[model samples]
Target: MTIDDHKSHLITLGKFLKQFQTSNSVMNSDIPGNNKFFEEMNQKIDSAIHHNGWFTRENIIFALQQWSEALTPRNLKLWLGEYDLSESGDKTVGIVMAGNIPLVGFHDFLSVLVSGHKVLVKLSTNDRQLLPVIASYLMHLDSRYENRIRFTDNRMKDFDAVIATGSNNTARYFEYYFKDKPSIIRKNRNSVAIITGNETKEELEKLSEDIFRYYGLGCRNVSKLYVPENYDFDSFFKAMYKWNPIINQDKYANNYDYNKAVYLMSEFKLLDNGFLMLKEDESFGSPIATLFYEKYQDEKELKDRLKENEEKIQCIVKKESNTNEVTFGQTQKPQLWDYADNIDTIDFLSKL
Candidate 1:
């Protein structure tokens, strides 16, 4: 499709999303009868939880809005560039979806759609419902999209290119399997932070959203902290305590217990007032209920270390530091201009 065509497609999808948000009465039902979209989203969220018993509807909506905003025509054109519909098309693109977190595969889906390529999406069992629902909604807005999209339980070998998302371990298998084809295989990654100055309670609360949202399963979730020596942990914990409701969910509680017990048995000193854990380490990523960290005093040394570790950190949340723009709960929520690995999707598709 041409750039115009891609833009039109996104506008149509956005309209459909807006309509869905308007017409559906079950979107965000968690907050009582708030808004139609929220209610509908809440229903889907509830169903997803009932089916998988893993994520909350709020997190799912948060992710959906993030993608929807990113895929807006203005943002898409900026990040993906204008599509060239006149260019020769690739045969098909095989997308292996990852279900470790909700809607993690949508960016690739948007790329396939805007590029006018046939997409054969192998849905992750953990996220089998949302994609189909989204596809159905898109088809309602533009039936043309229907012919280009396909969901399959079985893998087919005929494809011009592939994009697979998985853990660092599974990426090796994907590399071997799709090595002959042009592909982008994503391995596991986690985000981190550098705390230098005093943070307001609001900022810390928002940071807590990034830390606890989706139960720390997402790549953008901050799993590690870099704080100055003798930093007062009490202030940070006091600010973060507002989100204690996050632990109320049974699933999150289970994760907390499992990890906390393991740490205790291993003789790890948890920075806890009976809720969360903070440990000191060099790694950026950690499992739920625990955090890893390193102490830094010199700003130059911290910046150098962060630069060295850039490849491993998807995001670095910092206060009064020289780095990328930092936001609190918005870690997982990327804008349209935020290109993944700084690669322009449309440019890549056009080349293909």
Candidate 2:
């Protein structure tokens, strides 16, 4: 099949995804064989929470809605326009996916297939349920994908190149294992936000989403904060009130209790809001239900420090702090082109 053929299959899968969605889903009669697929997906979604507590209904739907909005004909064309896929002949691309968030590795999977390469994927045990169903729907859309898509729980072999995402230790293993081939090895990274003390309740409220979304498990979630020295956190804590409901999640509340106990026992100062804790710390990887904050002397010095530690960060979120700042509240809503770690997956696949 040609590149357009591959795209057409994904477009159909996106349409099928829309039928089960709550927000972006529509009653499109044109999406073929969606009745069975839609009902089946609904069952899987209902059971997803049992499989992985992090796969909440709302978060799963959010992931589906993002994909549905992204896989449109126009969006796909715009994303793929920069590359010459016609000359990008087929190769076998092995992918080791991360299960931090639902469909976390779908982009790499999509990139490999859309760029005319066969994909051999090892699904994260935490994310084992969803992608395979979507892959099956794609194969149903066109049987050609059956030849191109494969999944393995065992050791992987017989692939030209590899793309793996994991912790820093696993990343080192990937580097050594795939040293003989072209590869993209991803490591642990966290996101941070810079507050200028001028943000509106609306912006801070949205920033809360960046913090609470997916229980702050995603690399894009804002795990740290940079605030001007002597900045009052009254408004910041007030805006975060919306996510107070997250404290009801058992896993999150346990972490909150444990982290708060650790802080109290150690005599570390903290500002608590019943649900979330704001602790003055220098680390980027904050615990769930807690956000680490540090005071910045000025923009220049803070940006310099951030620049010096760019490798540890995934995205910088702010209202107007820097040129590359991702607008507040958009950390988890990255577009199709927002490459992880700014490494171009499509470009990597195209080269393979």
Candidate 3:
């Protein structure tokens, strides 16, 4: 199919996604195939929550809402405008999806298809319920999509290249197995925020979304913080209180209680405000219900250190934007062009 044909189908998919932007799935008769697909999509949302404890209705809807907002005609045009897709080749690209959050592997799926390639998907068992229904929606949009998308439960084969996302351990296996093929093997990466102690309470409150959304499971979540030495957390703690209800969720509460007990028994120093705990740590990845922080004495030295360790970091959130730094609250709300790991997915696909 032509590039315009692909864009037309995607824009329709985006409109279908708009109906589920909230937990209350309102029917939009203007969207095509709503009579057949809308109710089924709503049922699958609940099924996703049933299958995965972390897939709460609120977070699932939030993710859908973000995608609905992103898949506009303007966004599609702007993102694809830079590329020359007319020369794009048709290859079967194998995708190994990660299930940390709902639809986490979708961008790779979209990239392969939009850039004129067939996709062979291996869905993460935790997230198997959602994307198939989405693929069904696209197939409804156009029968041609049926030939473009394939989901496999068994071993993957007959693909010229691959894009895989996993933990550091699985990354090693992917690197070794896909050695001879063209690939993008992603490893564990975490985001961090820089608190200069000058942030407004409003800004910090927005920052809380970056910390607690999807219970901080996604790579875009800010798992660590860098604050000035002797930084008073009184305001920060007060701002975070908005999400106190997050602890009421059984899974999150269990993690909070268990992590707290371990810290107390080990006699490790911690900062607690009922729901979340903060500890001074040098690492980037922090466990759920806990946010690791380090005191920075010099901005220049810390920036240099962060630049030195760019591979381990996914995003650097700050009050000011410089190069790749995302503003507070926008980490999870990446635009179409904001590629993961600064690696251009479309550029990778165009030449394949």
Candidate 4:
């Protein structure tokens, strides 16, 4: 495929997706009617709660939109190639999807598809519906894509390259099993923030969405905070209080109780003011109902700490230094150019 071919294919896929998005029949009927998808998703959310204790539909929607936006022809060309479909040979790529969050592995799926390689995907039970639905739409646009893609339940073998996502512990297992092949093994990661005193109440409230959305289960969710010690907790809590409706949800409440009890039983020192927990920490990731906030005396110290922790952090949402405007929810809205780990996925695929 040439660069033109790639662009044409992407434009077609994009248009197809947009059509599917508006088509009531496809959107409403593609998913199983027996509540199977919901049941499976609920079960996955339950497991995530048991392990991490938070989940939200907001994160899932945010992730899907980010992916769709990034799939535009212009953006896809930048990551893939300007107009070259020079084959990297007959590459069979095995992708192991992660069920930690909904559609967590779509990026990997897009990478494989855009590369024009055969993709054998092992669907996570948590995300069974989304990928198939997406593939159905893609196939509707171009049957060629249907032939290139395959979903499997069997152990992957005879693949030229592999991409797997899992916890830090499971990553070791993936490395051992797929060591002989070229692979990208993704481990667990989380985002954090540096909250200067200059932020407004509205900003803090919006920040609450980032923390609570997806129950703080996503790698992009802000799990830690950096604030000045003199920063008043009164205003911060007031801003966060607006999101109290989050706890009223049955699933969120279940996770809240489970994690809250665990924290109490473990005797973790919590900065509790009735609803949320704030703790001081050096790590970027924190448990749900628990947020880590470190005190910094000056901007230089805060910048230094951010730089020191740059590799571990995914994003930082803060107010524009000179301006009073808040940039809170923007962290989750990644552009097409925002390649994961700053690695050019198209370049990686072209070589495979």
lDDT winner: 3
TM-score of each: 0.87, 0.96, 0.99, 0.80
Q: Which pairs clash in model 3?
A: none
Instruction: Estimate, for each residue in 314-344, the C-alpha lDDT of model 2 and write its tens digit.
Output: 9999985455569888888888888998899
* lDDT by candidate, in order shown: 0.72, 0.88, 0.93, 0.67
lDDT of 1 at 268: 81
lDDT of 3 by residue, 1-352 (tens): 8888888988988889888855457899999999999999999999999999999988999888888889999999999999998888679999999999999999999999999999999999999988999999889888988998999998889999999999999999999999999999999999999999999999999899999999999999999999998899999999999999998899999999999999999999999999999999999999999999999999999999999999999999998869899999998899989998889999999999
Instruction: Give lDDT for model 3.
Output: 0.93
lDDT (Cα, tens digit) per residue for candidate 4, span 120-170 = 999876666566766755565557776778899889877889888888898
lDDT of 1 by residue, 1-352 (tens): 4556657656655543442332242333332223423334445656776677665666666666666666576776666554455574655888998886777788888777767788889988888767776776566556777788888898656789888888889899999999899888887778887776478887787888878877888887889988888888888899878777867888778878898888889998778755578877666778777778778889788878878866676777765423464667678777765555556655666667
Instruction: Quote the RMSD, in angstroms, for model 1.
Output: 4.3
Top TM-score: which candidate number? 3
- At residue 47, what lDDT does model 2 achieve? 72
Q: Where does candidate 4 stray beyond 4 Å?
A: 1-63, 77-89, 265-267, 273-275, 321-327
**Model 2: residues >4 Å from true position, as ranges?**
22-28, 321-323
Clashes of each: 15, 0, 0, 5
CA lDDT of 317 in candidate 2? 94
